[model samples]
Target: MAKYHRIIMNGESYYREYRYGSDSYGEMLSEEELVHMLLEEVVDEEIEISEREIESALRRIPDREDRYLLQNYIRCLERVGRE
Candidate 1:
């Protein structure tokens, strides 16, 4: 059986299957997850991404473990005075 999760988009709500792409190396339905992972790597690299871009992506994600992880990441940046 497949599982699903509720997430928000454009102020509305929708039920999404987080593992819809599992047949493809555990890929999932959350584009945000993939992008978030990429950004996570970026955060550890020499790449430079604007805070606005990070926040904009953050707003697209609903409250979940990954979201919170990313949030905490940004919070750490803030604590270190990112701006």
Candidate 2:
């Protein structure tokens, strides 16, 4: 079974703590995993992103790689919204 983790998202730090699995991808999950799996999945599914969304995400993430990922996700969300 998959284990759940709790993470803080009070407008500051955000991170995922994988539970019920080893850091190496095979160990059992820790009891207090940090990955906010539920919120992440829900937000990803529900957000109807657009070009504006991409821009917003870019603004949120300063790192180039992270901005790329967020923009890609926003594009996918825009496509899903159009569909």
lDDT of 2 by residue, 14-77 (tens): 4334554455233333333334444555564565547676577578887989888877886788
Clashes of each: 0, 11
lDDT of 1 by residue, 3-75 (tens): 5565668865545555656632233445566456656755765768797998889888987787889999878
Candidate 1 worst ten-residue window by lDDT: 23-32
Backbone clash tally (model 1): 0
Candidate 2 at 51: error in angstroms? Answer: 6.3
Off by over 4 Å in 2: 1-57
TM-score of each: 0.32, 0.32
The 10-residue segment with the lowest total lDDT in model 2? 24-33
Alpha-carbon shift of residue 2 in model 1 (angstroms): 58
Q: lDDT of all the models against the reference?
A: 0.67, 0.56
